[model samples]
Target: MLTIDINKQLGDLDLQVNAQIPMQGICAIFGRSGAGKTSLVNILGGLSTPDNGQLTLGATHLYHQQQKINLPPERRRIGYVFQEARLFPHYSVRGNLNYGNKDKDQVHFDTVVGLLGLTELLNRYPATLSGGEKQRVAIGRALLTRPQMLLMDEPLAALDLPRKRELIPYLLQLAKTLNLPIIYVSHSLDEILQLADSMLVLDKGKVLVNGPLHAVWDSAEMRPWLPVKEQSSLLMATITELNQKYRMSKLSLADGTYLWINGMPLPTDSKLRVRIHANHVSVCINRPTDSSIRNILSSTIAEIIHSESNDNVQVKLAFGDDHIWANITPWACDDLALKVGQAVYAQIKGVSMTESELAQSF
Candidate 1:
């Protein structure tokens, strides 16, 4: 496990972070800009020092305020990838990768090249490569260093939508295929949802929440950071069927409610986590006789939350042990006469099932 208990004062901002992250999968540091996400990672990478704290990875002590133990950046064995691909323009892909290793044979060059799909671009220079390609090379360089852990700070933030999609699979593959631990920092919720097995949420340099992705994603503490229209709940389900002609997949939720999502055909029996946005779900008093919406599940009203404007309210619905949120106008809530324990039908208009939204459960 990775343990961190740190207190620092950076000018006007004070940072106090304490969390234990699992050493197996990707642990994401998520928050808005100026939340000190970068600063925390810098501390981990040995680029910055905290005023007082203790940090350890497995049995290695990276920092201890009282003991005066502090490792320099080069000795920390932590690889860092920033938002931009800071590659040397004069170096070729292979040259830049080799810069980290004293002996090329020390690391499996071919394996790293193949894993990141850089075999064809080894002879190319950084300027000739696309944004995604440059980032891939950056990752390969980091891996060649044989680091104990990797710190990635918004690695995909500089890429366009298409490039971001292209690079996400490689990240997922890295997380699954390698034994190395990763600390990913990002402000984008989509990226966190896609890659994070665990999450550490920061607000103004303070740790607000840290836990499994599902717990933190659905917790009340996360609601304020999410826009009213983008508020969502995550459902763990298994893909039971797929219709190739219609381009849709049927997922069976734990409560036995089957939901159809738009996407390329996925293998049957594949486990997935589906994001159901509040605005996409409409609460109905009774099942509609005919409707275009594909998913309508029986749910119970758990609680009602009114927005600050008071013009609308978000209804918390419970399906078996699972919970989801629905955003509707106060007038609609009154017309439907919603109350705690009332049975209602939730009509899910559509699910956002992009590559980033759907992650294969290990």
Candidate 2:
């Protein structure tokens, strides 16, 4: 169990966070810039001291205001990777990696080196390493510490598209094997979706919303903040087959149903995600007898939300465990007779963004 009750002031922003992160997997701090996410992670990692708080992981009390307990950074045994690689300009890649070691320890040398594929670049200097390589080495150096938890403060912010793309898979693999809770700070929504099992959204030092990744999307609080159109549903599926003749993709969902899509990132043998936008989805009272839409799934009306401007309605539907949204006019809602528990057909015409746009651009 990782718990925090902290109050601190930085510049014009004030932070009062009281949250608990279960001690496993990755948890992201999400928000726009100036939301005080970095400060919270810094305080957890012992890089910054909070005005008053009790910070602890399991039985270990890292910070206690009443007890006047505050551990130093080195003693905290927490790994940190910032957005900038911050590799030493003068040191060789290997030297910069080993600089944080309390002594000459060989415990994590080979495994860490191999995990990041740093063996080929150990002899190279930071100036010669690519952006991705430097970040990999930075992560390797942090992992070599064998810390209790990891603090990643927007590590991909400075990297280009290719660099970010190159690092995500490795980070996923690293997270799976780390066996420790990770405090990830990120401003990108897609980054949180891809890497985080859960997230906490911050706004001006206050926790706007925090829970499972989908919880942030489900809450009414997100209705105004989210771009009206970009909001969509996340559906997990297996690539059942490739329709080479028809130039389409087929995905098999867990609910014993198959959906045909344009194209996906997965190989025919792999699993991947498919996005269905509510605005792009049309509802029908019956399975259309003469419809061009290839993907039609059974759904029920769960909720009807009006547009922020009150010009249209956003219809929410339940399909098995997954939910999808649709943007329709008030007249259309009445015409279709949409209501909770009414059987309906979710017609999928040509999607807004194809399979490629379903996720974040690399």
Candidate 3:
């Protein structure tokens, strides 16, 4: 188990975090830029000293005030991948990788090279590599350290949208191959969905939520810093069918099949993710006549929460075990006579690709 209990002050806000993460899968540290997300991560990495508290991984004591124990960053055997790909500018990819291991051990080198697909670019200098390539090397270097845990501090932030797209899959693969837990810090919800298994939601130096991404994001804006156009809830679904020739994939949800504008990521009869935004779903009393919308799931209303800043109400609808939040105008809710337990069809309108997502095996 990875346990954390911390208290720190950054300017005006006070951060108090006490949480535990299972020693498996990625546990993303998610929040706004100044939410003290990075600070918490730094403390975990031994890069910053916490004012008070204790931290431990399995049996190793990383920090403790009462015990007066604090392990230095180097001795912690933790790997850190910073926002910038901090590769040695003068060294070739191979050299930078070789520097990760203290003894230049044969075991770590070949493993990291093969795992990160670095063999082809071994001779290339850091200056010659693309942003994605540099980041890939950075990851390989991190793996070669043979660390107990990995710390990623917005490792994709410097990369452009396209570069981020190119790198996410490889990072996901890294998470799966290495059993070591990762403390990933980022504000990007898509990145969290693509990689993290759980999250520690922080804001203004305080933790607001900490749990599985699915549980923490239920009908809430999990990360508001994400582009206003793309903020939404993510649902895990299975691949029901693939129409690759037409470039569309059908996903199986508890409610029904959700068709997305992409190829399927997982194999046939495998599970994938389908992101549905509150604004994208239109609530209707009856299934409307044929239209461009390909998804129409019948569900019962669970609850309706009004948006404080607008006339819209967030309608939570349950489909079997899954629930989707749809934002509808209060006036429209009145017109349709919506209420708890009301039968409704969540109409998914105008589906298109904003992220250059390729359906890789999740």
TM-score of 1: 0.95
Q: Write the per-residue lDDT of candidate 2 for residues 241-324, one digit (tens) a residue.
A: 887877677777778666787755566756665566667888888888878787788888888877768877887878778777
TM-score of each: 0.95, 0.90, 0.90
Q: lDDT of all predictions, in order shown?
A: 0.87, 0.79, 0.79
Between 1 and 3, whose lDDT is larger? 1
Question: What residue runs in model 2 are displaced by over 4 Å at the alpha carbon?
Answer: 103-107, 267-273, 334-337, 349-362
Candidate number that wins on lDDT, 2 or 3: 2
Per-residue error (Å), model 3, residue 168: 1.2
lDDT of 3 by residue, 73-165 (tens): 988888999888999998889889878677788876887788777889999999989888898899888888898889999999999998887
Best candidate according to lDDT = 1
The collision pairs in model 3 are none
CA lDDT, candidate 3, residue 96: 90
Tell me the spans in candidate 1 whose CA falls farther than 4 Å from its real position.
351-356
Better of 1 and 2 by lDDT: 1
Whole-model lDDT, model 1: 0.87
Q: Tell me which of candidates 1 and 2 scores higher on TM-score.
A: 1
Across residues 1-362, which tens digit of lDDT does each residue of candidate 1 receive?
A: 89999998988779899999998789999988988999999999999999999999889889999999999989988999888989999999999999897658744888888899999998999999999999999998998888889999999999999999899889988878777889999998888877888899999999888999989986888885677866888888899988889888888989788888888546999888777788778898888879988888888999998888897798999998898898899988888778999999999864455545576776
